[model samples]
Target: MTFQWDAIWGALPVLLEGAKLTLWISILGLLGGVVIGLVAGFARAYGGFFSNRLALVFIELIRGTPIMVQVMFIYFALPLMVPVRIDPFGAAVVTIMINSGAYIAEITRGAVLSINRGFREAGLALGLSGRDTLRYVIAPLAFRRMIPALGNQWIVSIKDTSLFIVIGVAELTRQGQEVIAGNFRAMEVWTAVAVIYLIITLALSYTLRRIEGRLKIL
Candidate 1:
């Protein structure tokens, strides 16, 4: 069958709204994930027994589960357990944060550990406190090393946001489904959706490449 430009054009605005929600979810999730990752990474790197065990448990729990299950649990199961109810969008963001956090923690931990032991010794010799050394010396270098991995996580998180459609969040996949339902044009709608996703992913990769280049120069 021929490609249907009209169907795609008609679906654009609806998909745009979904795209915006996806972007918001990804950005907020990435921010939360980075914070959790940094904390977990530090714990694994420097914290004593209790902190190390806790971080290990968290990372394992998140990484071991399917993200779809995590999203479903946050959206469906958590409300039954807690007084606070999160909407689909909030749930999606939270799941992304938790999922990405696990992966990012690994990245951070690896990056920090890969730094030469001499750096830590040098920091101590320079009279820097453990926290100060991590903040000033270790973290900066570790974060630079983490850029490429983090970029990959960001891309994965963005794609994963499509899973939020199960909870009724109007992300691109859900928008495409709606359009297909209305027009009975599944092939056309899905193709358009794929192209949109490709465009967004390419743009994001390009932007991150520029950022990586700048960071390398600094």
Candidate 2:
């Protein structure tokens, strides 16, 4: 079939709206994930027994399950069990937060642990409190190491927004499918959709690389 530029032009607006929704959910989700990951990561890396165990359970459980299942459980099953219902957008954002946070927690823990213990000791010897040492000395170094892994997770989470189509969040892929349904131009519409996703990921990667360059520790 000849590619239809007309179909591409017609679908661009709808697809861009979908892309905006996709970015909205991903940004909100990832921001929450960063908060969760930092707390959980610090717990796993340095907390006492109970806190470490709790963080470990959370990280392991979320990482073990598929994100699609997580989304379905939030949007479908949770309503059955609880007295509340969640919309598709809420479910999508929550699932991304939980799923991405698990991986990010591990990334955080590893980065923190990888730093030399002598740095912490030196900070303490310089009369810094443990909390201040962590905040000032350890965090800076660890965050530099975390940049690449965190970037990968962010990119993956953005692409994974496509799976929300199962519950009908109207993200980019779902919008593309809808456009194709109306015009019967799957080839053109899907090509445009893929290009949009590629562009988003590439832009994210470039931004991350620039941040990494500015923060290079060594």
Candidate 3:
């Protein structure tokens, strides 16, 4: 079969608009995930019994479940449980945030734990409080070490945005589906979608690698 450049070009504008929504969801989700991960990570690393247990439960719950199931639950079950109503886009974003946060929390915990104990001891000997020591000494080193893992998470989160398609969010994959339905050219439409996703993912990976290299030098 011959390649169809015109078809691909015709789909670009629609895909680009969908890509924007994908980006927005990923960005907001990553932000939310980071906040939750930071708190949960710190709690597991340093907080007392109640906090640690809560974090543990959260991590287990999210990590054990499928992300698709989580998304469906959030979109379908949440409204039944609570008075608030979340639209498809909002539900999808919330799902991404909660799902990604669990993995990120583990990443953060592992990074912090991998830091040398000697640094903590030295900081304590130098009269820094526990919080201050972590803030000034531990967190910096841990964050640097975590860059590679965090980069992996960022890519995962971006791809995970595709799951939002189930909820009727007009993300990249959803747009591709719509285009394919209209033209009845599944091969051309899907190939274009795959290429687009690959391009975005590769670009993100390249940028993250550069950032990781810079962090290593510090």
The stretch of ten residues in a row with the least summed lDDT in candidate 3 is: 209-218
Return whichever of 1 and 3 wins on lDDT. Answer: 1
**CA lDDT, every model vs. true structure:** 0.91, 0.95, 0.88
Q: What is the C-alpha lDDT profile of model 2 across 1-218, one tens digit per residue?
A: 79889999999999999999999999999989988999999999999999999999999999999999999999999999999999999999999999989988999999999999999999999999999999999998999999999999999999999999999999999999999899999999999999999999999999999999999885
Largest lDDT belongs to which candidate?
A: 2
Best by TM-score: 2
For each candidate in turn, give its C-alpha RMSD to the true structure in angstroms. Answer: 1.4, 0.9, 1.3
Q: Candidate 2 regions off by >4 Å?
A: none
Q: What is the TM-score of each candidate against the true structure?
A: 0.96, 0.98, 0.96
Q: Which segments of model 1 are wrong by more than 4 Å?
A: none
* Local accuracy of candidate 1 as per-residue lDDT tens digits, 9-127: 89889988888888899999999999999899888988999999999999999999999999999999998998889999899999999999999989999999988878888999999
Using TM-score as the measure, name the better of candidate 1 and candidate 2.
2
Model 3 regions lying over 4 Å from their true place: none
Model 3, position 145: C-alpha lDDT score: 86
Error of 3 at 114 (Å): 0.9
